[model samples]
Target: MNHFPLFADLKGRRVLVVGAGPVADRKIALLLAAGARVVVGARAAHPRVLARAHAGEIDLRLGEFNPAWLDDAWLAIAATDDRALNRKVSEAAAARRLFCNVVDDPELSSVQVPAIVDRSPVTIAISSGGSAPVIARRLRERIESLFDHSLGALADLARRRRPAIRAARPGLRARRAFYDWLLDGPVLGALRRGRPDEAERLLDEALAQAAAPPRGRVLLVGAGPGDPGLLTLRGLRALNEADVILHDRLVDAGVLSLARRDALLIDVGKAPGGRHEATQARIHALMVSHARQGRCVVRLKGGDPLVFGRGGEELQHLRRHGIDYEVVPGITAALACGAYAGIPLTHRDHAQSLTLATAHRRGGACADAEPESGRTRAYYMGVERLAGLRAQLLAGGLAPDTPCAIVENGSRSGQRALYATLENVENQARRHAIRSPALIIVGEVAALGRELAWFGEILDGEPATAATARLAAA
Candidate 1:
């Protein structure tokens, strides 16, 4: 964010380069390609510069660096090895109020060149503010592989049909919908297969059908457990396409940042002591209302929506209303919490089975089930009921010394894991001042966390107030 990215109109503009070496040669080539009238001033001109000058491709002046060379220039570049000469060029450009780039010296340059992926009319530029040029180039190379040479042809096709498409679909929304169809339909496929005629035909057919109203749909997306990286590609697509997003409070800001900037976001998460039924009713109403308006609606839920996330109710409601919908699954908390805490849910030697449950219902009633032997149990939102849950397990003939771990803010920067026995889990959590949005793991595998821990190195029987441990965990 240190620099605002912009595409300057340098076509038919005057540009000055203060060197004729390899560095200056590269800059001049780029300037010429951009349609800039480049002038190279150097005491000794490079062979390529002389050739270009002879061919009348560029203006070459054989002389030492001079402030007069910057006259009538829209942009200036100092690429000579002499630091003093580069500094002089920069100062002259500044006095003339012209933007200048000093080769390999970002501190003196007004603008730094970016690594670009060129698809002619479509260009993607990436810059690390001149701090990491190699990294920027690496990123550009990765992006280059995802796109093919056919993209230039695709852009050309779009440019040619824009006027006709706009005239056929007067509404902006309808026009955008037609383009989306064109890109996702057989037109793009035909282009990729090197059949331009077929692509144009498909485009014509789509344009003919643009008068029809666009269909509305719903996408049920899982935001995953705290980490944005865990979000699926399909989920990201749904977010970008959504006209409105209904998100839960537990969905992190990082995940929400991926959605369309102009998309309306509605928080449907139930607050403490809030009526669950009424909130659910409101969510249902919002989904139906938005979809009926021919808009794309996204119901974003934390973790896998189907796993105790009440996604079934929403799906049933959508089905009853005959709304088109798709579900994109996400990594649930059980997996994220266990991995981040360095505790596996199932181990061949320790746990052969796993059980996921909640300690309390939505109404705050104790829904604790007896802890089955030889099975790993993960309890969601159970930190507040640790005491009651522990008592219930003990009453059910569970061992008092059963290993347990409480993972707070799992997969997040503030994550903490406290390992203790079932008998003292409540005390350990209280001593460490544990909070909600935590998962409790109980099984023999929980004891393995002390040794198998990789993410954070907090050991069992150790005090949780160690600053180094928290920093490492973060």
Candidate 2:
């Protein structure tokens, strides 16, 4: 470490700022937020600084560079355009044994300010030892997105209950376990939902039952359709807290990478036409076994678990065994595929309603649900059943020329959107060799994809016409 990082307590302490520019104003604001008694010694004060001085918020001494200003200061900051003056302030502070920071001159300063992500009581500081401040700031930005405003409230709750928690569970291990429950259980959920009273009650209830062994729980998380960025915040939290993750084969590797590094990952994915019932039974057994051991189990499924992911069956199995569980919804393929393909599922001018269905059903039978006219229809896992789907929709009264789009590998790299009408959709699929993990969109709005297709335009791959050549041939 080039510099030893330490958070100073500036509450009621005098800090001197030797400039009146925007940079000095920023440092003064941070100091004031930390309750510092700011003393500004500058040739001329910035408008904001002058305003604060007039309001008696800070002490302002308008003058030339003076070493006398460092007399009673605990810390000093020199943020000026003049290099000589900034170095003079740094030398004066060094003589007085005070830590000073020179803006844009790291070598001349005794201290450097770090990039901060403030969740109040849970503030995170990132420092690059003044060697790479931009990199430090970028790192902080990435970390800041993972945490929300509720983290500070959660910290406050913990602080207020520390005394009671210590009294209830005096043993360090037991107390730590209690805190884990507080953070990973319903108390944190209540806090996230903006229910502080409920959070408090939940915490109290858990503390009252701290003597008992912690119960295991399961969270059914939707990993979204291939893209990790589409995963919900709550789903990400569940993955991070999981002791064991039962993930599907289709769940993107990017999504799995976000889980706790040490988490036990079990592939519970059932291959198409491969002993489906046996695979499902094994999934149920694994969830029950791990959860019974008081482990935090995550059932990570691709897309919205409830929509064709057999999430309902798993939920029923958990309920039958009396296991505690919660569900986190993900972006299903129909929604993600439609947006990425630029085919709005519902448009007032083209489609007033939307219908989601599956073309491929159990036992190789076409799903009996018929697509109605006027509403946009999206079919999941329909790549193989394109001909059957087209026939069924036509029989159900959709026009032969109704526009359609086949979105393959939706929301992922190498994603392709093939545009065609109902009459030639099956031909287009066969010509382009469209595969599974693709969605079938049928409606007047599907035609709009040709004009509004944005993702394809930006991506550096095959042109949209390459996939839609069959339509052009027709």
Candidate 3:
């Protein structure tokens, strides 16, 4: 509520980034990507920034931070960790009403940066104010796994043909319906296989047969979190036929690899570096354009599209537009991450109610900004926000003694888990040096993990054994 949710058009804009370290480098990277004329005020910069400067991509000012650095700047970022310096930079920006970030200090920031997942032509952002950056980042990562680089090509196809499609279909609803079909079907499959020719051919055929273009339909494709092996048959089928894949950052890379080679793989993923409505709009447009062109369109997403994937908004859009789209369910991160990490999402005695909560607000504000209420909780982006999450859960009718389990890199090699009671989980995670791209499950069932876990048995540094004993126990 404190900040407006809007994309700042950085193309041809001036952005001053104060700092040359990782955080400074991070902001500068995004500015440059938005086609801004970026200038950096720092004593020294990372090699990547230096390379950009040498290549004439940025203007770098060496040695220290100064208020004059804000002169004539359209936007600024106080990437320095020095709170004092960040505050000064922030004050300068506020005087001019120019946007600025104080890195981890949102209180001093005029703008807070969110995690971004970019596949050109399509981008997604996830924020959590400054309360839990790690959780926001993990959520972003989950979104990223749903799409690939092919989305650029998908966007290009639609852009090239938008005028004709609109002209042919006078009704916005009808036109949107047509686009919906093309995206989820042939167009997607064709592109995924690196066959643009096939995409065009199938599109023409479908259009020739339809009154307008093809009808749009909703698909419920499941992207099993982190483990490509966990994807279902229908999910794989849907992925191959996608025209516009709208995904989050936490999806598995291996799952994305299954998409057709030339498919219009979109990264409608919200994470750390990329955030914008342009990408979201582009996704809808791509679906509409392709469906109108009589190309099969797929709105591929991470997990079940209905679960925090915002499939509902899309369905509404499709309905209003009179597009025929179907919902293809995906494996929600909680289910996949928990199962693969040796923890069931729910159990009879452990959890009477299961809740999925976003660790962030709509504009990337932390849960502290507006803490969610839940019991028997499983958090999608709670790694960085563990402390906040723990506090919130404790306050929200959940006992402080509730058992919690942290799953990192679930469903794939390198998966690790940390189990503890609610009161000690935050400290446990800190003590164990846990990081982002992890999920937190809190409840009694989480305690059952030690007893019911088989994934850990496989990873327990012991060969798979005791089949007879396991059967007897079961």
Candidate 4:
């Protein structure tokens, strides 16, 4: 973010390069290709520079560096070996209010040239603000490999057919969909197969055909915990294709950023002290309304939507309205927290089964809840009701010494796991000031967090008051 990325229109402009080395030669070649009027200034000119000058391809001055060389120059590049000389050029360009690049010198340069992947009319630039050029170059190579060379031809076709595309699909949403089809469908395939005529004919026929109106559909996408990397590929695709995204508050900003730039983002997460049911109703309404408008709506929830995420409720509502929808499941908190905390939920020596439970119910905590023998019970959203849950477990003949672990911000960089026992879980949670969005695991496997913890901090058994853990919920 340190450098603002831009695609400057250097065509028909003048540029000055104050070096004759290979580095300068490379920069000069790129500038010339960009249609810049190149002027080379160096005490000793390279053979290539001399040849370009002799061929009237460039205006070359063989002499000491001069400030006058930057006159009428739209941009300047100082690629010389002398740091002082490059600094001088940078200062001179700064005085003229012209952007300049000091090769390999971030402090002296006003702008850093980025590594590029050029699919002409669709150029992608990667930069580390001149801090890590090698990394940028590596990224460029990866991007280059992912895109086909014929992509430029596809872009050219799109450019030529834009007018017809607009006329055929006047609606903005429909137009965008059509453009997506052009990229993903047979048009790009035809061009990639080196059949330009076939590609053009396909485009013409697609535009000539009576296009169906865009249909609205809902996609339930699971955003796993707080890590963007944990998102499923199907979830990522749903996000990119969404016209409207209604996401939970727990959904990370990094996850939301993966969606289309123009997609409308709405936070539909219920907040503390808010009417939960009403909030859910509003979310349902929003989804239905947007889908009815023929827009692709995405209900993005953290963790598996069906696993205590109320995804089933949303699906039922969609079905009542006969709306089209798809589900992309995500890694639930129980699984994520256990793995991240290095506590296997179903260790053969500890637990025989796994129970996914909610701490609070509509009627309140299930007072008569029974703990199954040798089962690992993962309590969702249970941080605030730990005391009540502890009492219920104890009343139901659960062992007082049964091990427990509270995982906060699971799967995230700031994750913390607090290990305690059923008898002391409430006390330990109170001492730690555990917050919501935390998951509670009650079983012998929970004790493994202390010895097996890997991803985050672990708060083990301690008697000191100052050693309080801060376990916050999502």
The C-alpha lDDT values of all candidates are: 0.86, 0.86, 0.71, 0.88
Q: Residues 280-349, candidate 3: write the lDDT tens digits.
A: 6766676666666655567766667787666787778777777777665667778877787667665553
Candidate 1: how many backbone clashes? 0
| Positional deviation of residue 130's Cα in model 1 after best superposition, in angstroms | 1.0
Model 2 residue 109 distance off true place after TM-score fit, in angstroms: 19
Model 3 CA deviation exceeding 4 Å by range: 1-220, 243-247, 276-278, 363-375, 456-474
Task: List candidate 2 segments past 4 Å from native.
Answer: 1-177, 180-209, 368-371, 395-397, 457-474
lDDT of 1 by residue, 1-474 (tens): 799898888899999999998889999999998999999999888898889999998999987788999889999999999999899999999999999999788888998889899887888899988888899999999999998777877889999998988889987558767777776777878888999999999888877763878677889999999889989898998898999999998899999999999899999998766898899999999999999998899999999989878899999999999999999999999999899888889877668899898887756665445666568989988887889888888887778877889888888877888888888888878888888788899887787676566664353544434323532432
User: How does candidate 1 score on lDDT?
Assistant: 0.86
lDDT tens digits, residues 331-415, model 2? Answer: 9999999999988888776688887888767777765445565588888888877888788778877777778888988999868
> Which segments of model 4 are wrong by more than 4 Å?
367-374, 462-474
**Candidate 1: where are CA atoms >4 Å away?**
362-368, 456-474
> 1 or 2: which has the higher TM-score?
1
Best by TM-score: 4
lDDT of 2 at 457: 32
Could you give candidate 4's per-residue lDDT for residues 1-474 as a string of tens digits? 577888889998999999988898899888888899999999888888788889988898888999999999999999999998999999999999999999998999999899989899788889998998999999998999999888899999999888989999899888888888888899899988999999999999988887788899999999998899999998998998999999998899999999999999999998877899999999999999999999999999999989998899999999999899999999999999999998899977768998899987887956345767668999998887778888888999898877788999998878888888888888778887778779998887877676678898888744322122211110
